[model samples]
Target: MRPIWVWLKGPLPAVPWPHSESRPDVDLTPEHVVVVGASLAGLRAVEAARRLGFPGRLTLVGDEEHLPYDRPPLSKEYLGDLPGVAPMLATAEDLRELDVELLLGAPAEALDLTARSLLIGGESVAYDRLLIATGATPRRLPGSEGLSGVCTLRGLSDAIRIRAAFDAGARVVVIGAGFIGSELASSARARGLDVTIVEALTTPLVRAVGAGAGAALSALHERNGTELLCGVGVEGLEQQRGAVTGVRLADGRLLPADLVIVGIGVVPATGWLAGSGLELENGIVVDETLRATADVWAAGDVARWMSPDFETLLRLEHWTNAAEMGAHAMKNLLDPEAAEPYRHIPYFWSDWYGHRIQFAGVPTGEPEVVTGSWTSDEFAALYHDGDRVVGALTLDRRGDIMKYRAMIGRRTSRREALAFAASRRQPIVAAAG
Candidate 1:
């Protein structure tokens, strides 16, 4: 596979990468801090701000009518008809205890950076400090709209709707083989429904995990009876009476489907910040301290902050990153004078067909050394940038992910990591024939 560093480059070349964690000494505690976006990141920011004893008016503004809810389960447990409870991030009592004023269903129409105010629900809400944790919106395939049974699994409502259709024995066709699509396929297979995943890449999760691990995941999915159509592009959606029936491939092939899930990916939810004059590329460009501007800060999927660890600007969309960044964003908002760079060892996990896949660090570059067999069900592959172990991917190997995560933090050498992984006592478990 080609290097991922190359792909991360060349996007918005004008914005320079932050090289140092230095900012002017400006100490002013605001009486009110408005956190836009009421999702996981937004909720965590408010919680952290309150926990840190920020004796200010904390307001959370959300576009969705429902309160902040967990999103990761939307593709897993919540995709089934077993228990359809909306997993909330913060309940009424929790919000009350935290003393957070929640303005749900009020989407910020515009951000007045100069005036330090947000236009929400036709009223200008001024803030001493502003946090843009608006997150991101899923990208939909062109012409996929106006068709029934077409869904994007980004919100709680979308999961419920898809679960109901799947329970009714609808043939599932997922448009992307990313984590969401793969997880949804696994969930659909659990319901004994016909599931097919179409991916443009040669292997599943090629971008996140390396080629070897991605191939292992692809094999696992196929073994579990999930048909994977990789290295193919979807041309259009076939509709019958305003309902999607199937997907037409670029190669002039049709795959029948009763319900179509578009998990292609997401774009940063920064469209509302347009004309506000904040640096906007793929996301709100932030400094190492997660500061978008002098007083404006962003977190979660909306803010692309320079990573001191990786020495690159990263906009991580995983749940863990969102939680960690949310907490750090609040801390920085309270004390931007500290200029503590948000340096973190990125980590995320996924479950597919009963196998737990965990990865840490930037899983880019080439996999030069392997601990166990890649073809095996349980093994760990170490990726390296030259001699430095840059990242790691583990399948069904619990507890070992942390070891590699720390190793990446320490910048362990390739030889040391390979020897350490090879010295593990667990015997290699072969893939079931």
Candidate 2:
């Protein structure tokens, strides 16, 4: 078998070998490994465990009746004119080959850490090892419950319903200008529907990418013929005959709409985990190795684990982070004695107005445009906290963003980042638009 090298903080160990194949030097395999949440992360965890030669019983439990499916496209292509079935992460045959038991439809009701069991559908399932990857649920608009033409996109069923509204040529009002909301607005406009975005912040994505970059990104809406209302709060939903008719603004204006997509945010799915004796802050508080407690682990959006590299706690809700965390957490679970800290630089990409926007690392300090001009709509910006490059954002510079991502991981200095940008042979703008 090919050797797997583990990266440590300092110099490499003398005997460099696959940690999974070499560590512990004793049997640590569990009889039954039960994973809660059959989404991307949970599924990946099961696959990873089997690949690491754990010939044990594995079970995947999910609240949704359908098998695990990809979610990124739910707000993009899935809502477009030619909507296709939600893409599955694993097929029935795939799971069969993995030799795993599957439980669908019933959500995990509670977790009994002391008893080492999970309660699902009024039944207790015992397990020697447990992994929680329950993911998250979308936050809803206040007073919009039970109203027709109101929706929040989080799953396949939500996408199918929203797609029907778009097909009917509904005038859409998207609340919040975050990634999900922005993507929904983009798809609405692509379908030739009148779209308007309402953002409470003065600038959209200000919290995620800072003011200047957020403003630059918000401009894409206007350029694509969509109206973007910023610095405005939603008072409530205007309804007629139990159907949403418009959104009343705090400033005494009502934006007429036939459909309203609430993309405010999502909270971690921890209600079922209440009193589970696990530390639950914004998410399930896990250590650097994603261990919540002895014999228990958490991953994906539900996990708020410490980042050894950044020296802080982070809970990421992105496709790449979820997929990576699943495999890492499982490997760590299998080899508890030799578990390693998960040092990852957050990365995500989005499609808007025919432009692919990608960002890596945590956005900190002022953004310095290093390549191309914002006017050209092809640029890369570096973010620095003191002398260390902490983050990078790019608009239509796909090939160059990963280079900056690597730099962020290495904690590249500002001078070094600038020099690398200069080597690109492209004019570097001094300020981001």
Candidate 3:
């Protein structure tokens, strides 16, 4: 049986069929550039290809029928107060003016690395250049398919479902305390609904933003009447007649829920490229230049690029990171040898319960930490690797964080930073960095 979503396949106005796929007759010169994914990274990639003077066929392939739009609002503004904000790609009327074809809703069914062509919908689309901006999918518990009232928020439909559940005041149980989960909980609370957030980790956001930030976030959720179950693991989901009713913890606790939000985080949406010969550990592994392998590049939350300093692959789902990485990936796709390497002080911003929090740099493996607060709602917490500052987290006071982000551009000393924190205006310190 054909899926109900098959009607979702087609090309939009300027967003025509994604060219630059592995098709014959496409010039190797700057004549054809195909970009996959129509959302944040894919959209930006097309623009970058244009900027690189690629004066030829531009094709964009996306998995979603809806043109690219913002995801940050899904859990906050879109669900809480605002109603008319829908997902949309950037106003590329300029690209429309340039005759770039956009292929919407048809995902790459298979990737032929040897052929350098993607068999999208069983048709071989050739390309002089290709950009894989596939993006990420929500990480969910195993065996969750066909569970009614259970969903993960990563795309338009997910947001629509979760948002509908919130408006209905469904008894919501969210798994994971990561950024997405926290935002969902806070948004649900704002709508005056019963929401419970279940976290498997000890501290929320500590894995990504560190402990102090996590503690503050937990406190905020508690103060706002959201129940947070820490140190709890969801072993399995309970269903009554194929409909989700509750969540079962590994410790033998049954958490009843009319609706459950799983924010366990996201996995790179790279499953389509299984045999594409790309080095994919968890995602499409790319280099510093955002180049995956020969004639291939990836970006956004799906691309796991090697970190400059750290010996690890960093796949940040931050908004700023997505924009930065997408731009860089596009540049490389045009001219692999002439493109600049990708490196940005990773930053993420989230708003919840009237608090605007911003963070820069990856807060990982901190031995000792020093924090500074401000009279204004702006303050920065510094994460340290021994005596060197590696990461910083900020709250309401974003300007100070802006400055700190600039200061810690390459690296900084912990002692000097701590001095600034101690003698400064609003100082708040938590020794656990």
Model 1: number of backbone collisions? 0
Give the per-residue lDDT of model 1 (tens digit) for 1-433: 1111101111122322122223334444678998998898999998888666676677888887787899998888787657777788867767777777777665788988889888887778899899999999999988877789999987888888898898789998999998889999999999999999999988777777767677877888879999999999999998889999899999999999999999999999999889999999999999999998888999999999899998998998889989989999999888776669998888888898889988888877656436557776677778888888888888888868899999999999988887888767345533342
Candidate 3, residues 147-192, lDDT tens digits: the string is 8899988788888888788777788898988878888888888888
Q: What's the C-alpha lDDT at position 2 in model 3?
A: 14
Residue-level lDDT of model 2, residues 296-318, one tens digit each, is 99999999999987888999999
Report every candidate's CA lDDT.
Answer: 0.83, 0.87, 0.74
Pull out the clashing pairs in model 2: none
- Choose the strongest candidate by lDDT: 2
The global Cα lDDT (0 to 1) of model 1 is 0.83
TM-score of each: 0.91, 0.92, 0.86
Candidate 1 differs from the real structure by a C-alpha RMSD in angstroms, to one decimal, of 9.1
TM-score, structure 3 vs. true: 0.86
lDDT of 1 at 258: 92
Order by TM-score, highest first? 2, 1, 3
Better of 1 and 2 by TM-score: 2
Error of 2 at 230 (Å): 0.8
